[model samples]
Structures are given as structure tokens and as C-alpha cells.
Target: MPATDLVTAELTLTGRITTASNATFLGSIGDVAVVYKPIAGESPLWDFPRGTLALREVAAYQVSQVFGWNVVPHTWLRDGPFGEGMVQLWQEQDPAQSAVNLVATDHVPEVGWKHVLEGQDESGQMVALIHEDTPALRRMAVFDVVVNNADRKGDHILAMTDGHRHGVDHGLTFHRDHKLRSVLWGWLGDALTVEELEGIDRVSEGLNGGLGRDLAELLSAEEIGSLAVRCDRLRLSERFPAPSGEMSAVPWPLF
Candidate 1:
């Protein structure tokens, strides 16, 4: 069956993801499982305009595809039982692994991990936020920067059983202003690898092609321009960026 046909088929909602800030439902199209977020169900944000979240979610997927990072799952906009919404192919994450963790300060790994920050836990024990220093996560961090992702919570990173990582809940992306609040700040100030640079180059070159065209449909002209500027800036800097701006560097309730 064609891709469109698969998505257009009756989506039977199996359960609701109540933990999601927005209305999110788990459903299946025939045998294919998916996550659905209807445009009508999105709560209006003071910063982000209303009804555009679903489009932004789809646009994030498009950017991931252009960079060939496979960081985001297959996402698209379609009519569902609730209304028009964003639907993404559901990925089962490994139960035992998480991309980000709060380890006891002394338990922090000496190598192969980037320590983000140190803080006191609920029991008054000192803990540190750390993420694995791997190429897959680095790619996701880079993608988040380019998209101006504002709410990259720790739970948003999915660790697959095959060792691949996926980022989700990208509705808070692509703002014209710099609103990159994320927990993946482990690579700050590190130089971009040759392969990472090549990925940026690919995105830069493709902006005026299919990627640009697809984004134009979802974002305003100025937003698209801003995205292009971010790509060019990252390519020129050739390094992972440090947190800036007067706003908080990371999202609240870090989990």
C-alpha cells in the first residue's frame, strides 16, 4: 500500500499519552503504531502562535531527513479521528537505556560522557546531569541547534534497542528568534567533526531545493530565512555552540 493510503486508513486510538503536555494519543493504522497530536488539541503558547505546532512538528521531520541524521521518526500531517493533526511512526525504546541521566556525582563516568551540570537531588545528595558522548547524540544536538528547538526535554530522546537514538516532540521548533532550550548541552564548545560539517553543508545546499520548499509551506518567509541563517552560522563557526541569551539555557522540570 502507498504511504498516503497507510496514514489515511482508519486510525484506531489505543490509548492516550497523558504525560504529554499537549493532547497526544497512541493509535494504530492497520498494524502500524503511531503517535497523534491534533492541531486543535494544542494549547496556545505565549511565544509560539496557535495552530502551527503540528506544522512545525512535520517540518522538523523534514529537516532531519535533509540532514540524513534519522534523528526524528517519520512524521506527517493528516486527518484523524480528532481533527487534522501530526502523526508520527511510533518507535519502541529500550526499557533499560536513556540518553540523559542524573548520576551520583561520584558515579559519573570518567570517559565517554559529557557532564552537563551538578545539582542537589531531592534527598540532598549531589547529582550531575550527564549524557553519553556518542556520534548519534551529537547529531541530534546539532539538529536541535539548527531548528531552534525550545523544549528538548530528557524524556524526548528515545533509545532504541538497536542503539539508534530518536528525538521527538519537536512542535516547539523553528522560531525566528533563538529559543534553543535543551538538555543536550554536553557538546558545548566542542569542535564539529568533519562528518558533522558535511551534514550541515548538505542542509545548506538543499535549503533552496526541496527542503526549503517544504519548510516554506509550514513556516513563514522570515522563519525560513532565520533557519537558513542558523545553518550558515553553524557552518561558519565549525563548533558546537555554548548557551547564550538572557533566557534560561535549559527547560524546566529537566525530565
Candidate 2:
């Protein structure tokens, strides 16, 4: 869909975010928290791969809006300390909380709050993951599958204090093929709930209305067609389908 027309002024860099993979800077345009990443002018990390990463991130955010999930608010692409880049409205999450702490063999009563965990690896590299699930979230998992999201890490889920879940970091989504790799496997063999089917139906119906035309500008025809196919399958099955090929199962260490 066409992005919401939110006017964002040029943000000024206030400090450095030492924990991020790229050269992230903390900034603000008015009262909004902005994260800035400049294009690499020198040697760069292989994982980021430069060039189209910024565009991909923007596209992902737009797609997330279609799923009706709370996402890190995307404003616009702009010139930054490095070069052309993206600026997102910063989401305030508990810095000390993580999903790992929430999961246990003993079930915790579903309080409907999901926590986003941001931490460093053994070598002190920053990483994030999501760690909360409810009946509502299970529906989101099915939405991720329809989008062919290749990265749905635990850190991507953000837990707000008021018991709402926000997902982030969707740059690696909308593949034309089945590339879904996530850590949400609790419902591996469970039947798809009726609510889940309804959610998918809403998205599919929205596609033909406005969403399809908008996505056509950013995604290939094949990719959009694949998304429709996924929706149809879910609607027909009325439950989670068994893994058909190697790609259907969740990927390990989903980050």
C-alpha cells in the first residue's frame, strides 16, 4: 500500500548505538527516536551486502502493515551521516527482557504479552529475537508464512508494557519461493484456528482491493502471485499443513 503520509523532518545524530551490527546512530526529529544507518564507504560486513538493503527494509515494513501487526514505524528514506539510508520511529522496549526467559517446559499462562530480546552474542556482537506467543500470535505465524519471511527471529518480537506484541526487522521477507525460517514452532502440527483463517482471508481480500496494486510497485509479479497461492492454501486446508518440502520447517537459530 502507499505509505502513510507522515511528514518526517531531517533527523540530527545525537549519539552512537554501539550495540548494533552497522554504524547505527541515535537521533531525533522532533520527539521521535530515529535509528540511522549510513551506506558503507569503506570495507563492509558481508552479511549486510550493501546496495539494496535499505530499499528491502522499506519494502518489508510496508508489507508488515498489510498483515495488520504493530511494526516499528517507518517514516522515510533520507540522507544520513554516511549516505542514503532509512529512518524508523524507535520503539521503547524493556532493555533487560528477553523471550528466552519466558519460555519453559512448564507452561506460563497466556498473558498476551510478548517480549523482544536484544543482546550480544558470545563474541559481543549485537542480536535480537522474539519470545512470546499467544493464540493471537499463532495467527501472525501463518501470516509470516504467506509472506515467505526468511528471518523471523525471537528478537524481532517486541513486548510493550501494556501486553501488546510488535514485530520488527522484516528486511528478509517477501521471497517468491518458500523461504520461511522462524523459531515459532509450538504449533507445528496443530490445526489452524478459525480466527487464523479469518485473518488470512482479510489479507487476501485486501490484496485485490488496494494492497495488490501497491505491492506491485515494489515486488515482482511472481512474488505477489505466490502470496495469493499461500492464502488460498491456508483457506482451503483450514489447518496448518504438513511440511511438503525442506523449506516448510522452521530454520535453526532463527535470527
Candidate 3:
């Protein structure tokens, strides 16, 4: 099936995302900003472990929903012109704004990192990153730790004009073993706030419901169980735990 048949709107390819492991396109579904990945003729650079990218992206979106953060909109998996691929609601970010540029001069206010990467969704339409110091981002950091996100680079963060920080490029996540790597180290040793703790509780509780069912299809039983185990360890430790074992603390830079 073509992308149009699986998706609701007509897709117009704006450009290609050459930076990704797979061939991705920046397109619009009607008026929505969307990222399109085609499975056919995928780049050979993606030689990581099996089920690595898709599983990680899906898990990240699901966990973001549980934590109530504004993650990139994940539409559905469908058959596209290239092959089986995933479609995501596109995020519009100002070309001039970046977390890297800002981090040099000022600190990201408590929980306000999400709002810094806002931009126009489509038609050059602008949206502001909603800025508020809350426990939500803290919780997200914890989730990243548990899942072992190895690519939380600064550029992956899109800061909206309104101040909402949008996280992108979650393809490197949810390793069965510890593989967490990121640049959000400001809260490494900070204790989990009450709200943050509650969010983790919510994810733990969600595993038995829709979240569990969904993960069962994409991840192995051992992987799913490991996710729960990480949460438990985080809860018990009450702070960012030190890295253990022989795995590298970061991913090899593809660039």
C-alpha cells in the first residue's frame, strides 16, 4: 500500500532527512509536519542490533504519553512507497534556536527544556514551546535513564519560540541491557521529586494495561521485564544510579 492509502491525508515530500540512519523525508500530511521513513533501499549505515530503532522509538512515545510530555506525534506504522515504515507528526522548530546555543550562556530552567524547541508545524506556522518549571521533565530524564537512551544529543532538542522543549530522534532507546547515554546531565544526582516519582509509578502501573500489551508485540518478554526492573531500581535508588558493567556509556557518533 502507498503512504496515502495507509495515512489519512495526502503526503507532499518537502525534503529528505539525510542525517538519519535510514532515509527519512520531511513532508506534510495535509497541513501537519511529518517525518516519513521508507523501508526499501534503507541506508546501510544502520547496522545496530536487531529491532533496535523501531522498538526504541515506539517505546519512547508510549512512555512520553504516560509522563504527559509533548513528544513528537507518532501516527502509525504503515506500508509506504519504500516499504513498511513509521510516520510521525512533524515538529516545526525555529531554525535559529537550539538547546546547544542556549546552554552555553544560561541554564535550562527547571523542567522548561521541553519548550525550547518549538517551531512552525507546517505552512511556516509558528508554535511556541510552552515553558513551565514542573516535575514532568525530571520524570522524563528518569525514563531515559531506565531505557538507556544513547543519543540524547543537544541538537535533538527543538526549542519552540513559546519555550516548549520537544525531544526528537528517539530511535536509540530501550536496550535490553543498560545503554543509557545523553547530554541532560544537570539532574544526574538530583532526587526524584514527588511528581517525578508518581510518573514512574504510573508507567509501572501502565505496563499491565495497554502499554504492556503494546510492548509485548514489539519487544521481547525479557526486554519488557527489564524495563520494569529498571523502573524498580530507579524507585529503590531514589537518585541517578551509576553506570555498571562493561557497556560503553555513550554511542559511537555516526557523524
Candidate 4:
């Protein structure tokens, strides 16, 4: 479908996604399915700016477009059934596949995967969090760092049948603080690849032009400046940063 149609078509609500922290709905703009989060339905947060999550979501998509990694799905803000909100093209991920998983500590895959951490499950069984050590997932980890994503629980990652990995639910992003929390820590401290460096370069160069102008509409000046700073640090350090400071390294309820 043409992108213009998505913006102009009437959005009809088909169902509700009960698990979302804020109000989220499954709907369609004609035949194209979409996920919608109304700004009015946004819950208050202690740190993030009030009622700005929808903007941040669209901003995340803008950043992803500049990166050319498709880390995030196509996202935009428009008026919906509940008024103004963020609307995104819904992606139907492969049902039988999972990019991240939990397994018994001893049975963790010795190849093609990376172990993140170990803990006891609800039933008291020892288990480990692990994810596929694929290039796609690696790009997502890098994307999370660039966006300062604050909530990267396991379920946020969608595994596509074609082997692509898509990261979703980007409402908590573009903070001017080090708020990154993710399940993609499998590549911590790894050296950045040439292609990865190039992607960062694209974002850096774009910041002074169209990308910068677009973000100015969705994020505060401080938040946009912090994004540039993160890009510079990523380029200079040339490695995945280990979680540090007083902030928790990972999100709670992992999944």
C-alpha cells in the first residue's frame, strides 16, 4: 500500500492488545493492519516526559530509517479512533521461531548463540537467558544503544521467517540520559563491524540535515543533542558498552 493511504485512511479498531502497558489496539487502515497507541491513553511515567511516548515512538522510527537497518518497523503519528496517536505497520512475525529463549543452564546451545545471564525460574529451576548470535540481532543491540532504548524486554524482539529480527515497542526511547536496558547484551564489548560503523556514520551525517530537522519536531533539544553524543561515543569507543552506573543493567520481568 502507498504510504499516503495509511495516513489518510480511516483507522478502524479491530481488537485490543491487553498486555500492553499503555492502551494499544489492533486495527486496519482499509486492508493494511496496524498497531495504534493513543496519546490520551499513555500512562504516566516517573522519568520520561509526560504524554510524549507516541512522539518518541515515531522518532525511533525516523532514526531507524536513517540507520538503514530496518531495526524498527515503519512508524508514524496520525489521528485515530481515540484521537492523535502513534500508528505503526503491524508485522506478523513467524510463529514457530524465537530469537531469544530460556533454557536449562546445562543445555544452553554451545554454538550459534550467546548466553546472557543465569537465574532461577518461577518453579525454582536453574535457567539461562540466551539469544541467537546472528548479525540481525546484533544490529538490534546496536540500534538499542543508539536510541537509548529504556525498555528492551525479551518479547520486544520479533523473529521473522526470513531470519530478519525486528525490534518493536519503542515508546521509551530518545532520553537525554543513559536509560538503555535490554536483553540483547549478548554482544557486549564486541568490536563494531565495518558495516555497523558505516550505519553510524549515516546517522551522524544525517543529524546535521534532514534527520536532525525531523527529530527536532519529536524530541527536545537536549534529547536530540544526547543522541548525537551517543553516536560520537559509539564511533570513538568502537565496542559495545557494558552496562554501568546506578541504573539496573536489564529490565525486570525480562520477557
Candidate 4 lDDT at 191 equals 100
Better candidate by TM-score, 2 or 3: 3
lDDT of 4: 0.94
lDDT of 3 by residue, 176-246 (tens): 76777655555656687776677778788888898888878766788789888988888887886665678
RMSD, every candidate, angstroms: 0.9, 6.0, 8.0, 0.7
Q: Sort every candidate by TM-score, greatest first.
A: 4, 1, 3, 2
Model 2 poorest ten-residue lDDT run? 1-10
lDDT of 2 at 224: 74
Q: Is candidate 1 or candidate 4 better by TM-score?
A: 4
The lDDT values for all models are: 0.93, 0.62, 0.64, 0.94
lDDT of 1 by residue, 190-230 (tens): 99999899998888888889899888899999999999999
Best by TM-score: 4
Reference-based lDDT, residue 19, model 3: 73
**Could you tally the backbone clashes for each prediction?**
0, 5, 22, 0
Candidate 1 lDDT (Cα, whole model)? 0.93
TM-scores for candidates 1 onward, in order: 0.98, 0.72, 0.76, 0.99
Better by TM-score, candidate 4 or 3: 4
Candidate order by decreasing lDDT: 4, 1, 3, 2
